[model samples]
Target: MTEMTRRDAPAAIRAIGHVSTLCGVVAAALIFVSVLITCQMIFLRAVLGQSTVWQTEAVIYMMIGATLLGLPYVQKLRGHVGVDLVPGLLPAGARKALALAVLSATIVMIGLMLFYGWEMFHLAWERNWRSETVWGVKLWIPYLAVPLGFALFALQLVADLWAVATGHDDADPNVAPEDRRH
Candidate 1:
């Protein structure tokens, strides 16, 4: 690789890493909001003898959204479950190839997810679908998290692939030497 290209790769990786981190923060906030709403719902039911309307549905959507949005961040942290036993036994060259193959397969899977997710979100939006619950909240709004999350996840996967292919796997501080092989 040219010196300039090598220099740019790490920089690009860092930028993508920042985006993943921001997504993590957003995911955390969504969970926090869901928790707060749940607490409020409990208080309303127990103390005020009032039934909740949107709280339950809202919490469910937010929790799902949080899980979706947290994907890239989890990958970034190498928090996803992985077995390094096979890769660990391989020579450096073989290990690198394995990493490339695994990363490539992951990217393709996430891309498929992104495509279908977008399709689902688009259908819901075009049909003006709404939840059947008392809240009758718009389905597209929450459905959007599907595509958005997968897109972010694919981006992170591409970054990881690039790092591995270019011998810059250390771009992510969370990546240990053993994890890099996988």
Candidate 2:
């Protein structure tokens, strides 16, 4: 990508990435809070000889939410694990093509997830589903994250494909920085 195009990539795409980053930060915070709560639960159970009820269920839900909500941010940062040896050996044109192909496949998979996730969320909402646990938390609340996360991930993937096609993303999509020198 030309320096000019890099500077000129659509503001919308940049905005989406920024939102994804914010969501990721929130996910991290949720995980941190979950850990703290779990510790508290342990203390109450072991140290104080008190019964713990909601903590375990809450922690599990938070962790699941965190994982789902972090997807877009991970994609935005290119943090997902991938093998890059083949792309590294290929010429620039071939590399770009491969990147596009991989991104396209990712988009398709995420898109499908988004669709099915939404369906799941809707079903839970409509049926007033609740967990079987004593906490009995609404299932739709957590299910909501599934579609939302996949949708954001799909959007991020589209932005990445656009960046690659426009030369805004000059680095090989498949290769990590540390591995690039090899």
Candidate 3:
């Protein structure tokens, strides 16, 4: 293992990181769109005294999509909460081992989610499922986000694992910089 940063990451890892950044941007856009729709819905219902049909359902789907699709970006930024007390106490070699183990476990879990998510999406598409609401949006469209998000998330996890294995990661965040492996 050697000391490295994202700039030193392999091309594939960097590519994944780029995609994660794109996802983050798109997630922010989705949130913005949801907010705009909510405002419009409020205006129509209150000021204009008009009944809204699709606004509520659309907002819900957009929010869920934003959350799922934002996963890879969050992982890329290491924004998720972590408990690193034990890793911080370990020596460099053991710390690296722990990072590998945790990353591997997470990848496997996300892989499962991707698999099942795709299955659900496939079923919805094949069955031509639609929401029962007045808007009657196609279920597959919203469900598509699930598998897509998990897949990107899994890719990000793989990139993270690569970083750890290659010593590109500052594995134990709780450790002092001077104490970390060089």
TM-score of 1: 0.89
What value does the lDDT take at residue 163 in candidate 3? 79
Q: What is the TM-score of each candidate against the true structure?
A: 0.89, 0.90, 0.92
**lDDT score of residue 137 within candidate 1:** 96
Would you list the clashing residue pairs of candidate 3?
A: none
At residue 82, what lDDT does model 2 achieve?
88
Put down candidate 1 lDDT per residue, 1-182, tens digits, no spaces: 22444466678887888999999999999999999999999999999999999999999999999999999998888788899799867777778888889989999999999999999999999999999998999999999999999999999999988887877664333344644333
Could you tell which candidate, 2 or 3, scores higher by TM-score? Answer: 3
Q: Which portions of model 2 show Cα errors greater than 4 Å?
A: 1-6, 172-182
Alpha-carbon runs more than 4 Å astray in model 3: 1-4, 172-182
The superposed Cα distance between candidate 3 and the true structure at residue 163, in angstroms, equals: 1.0
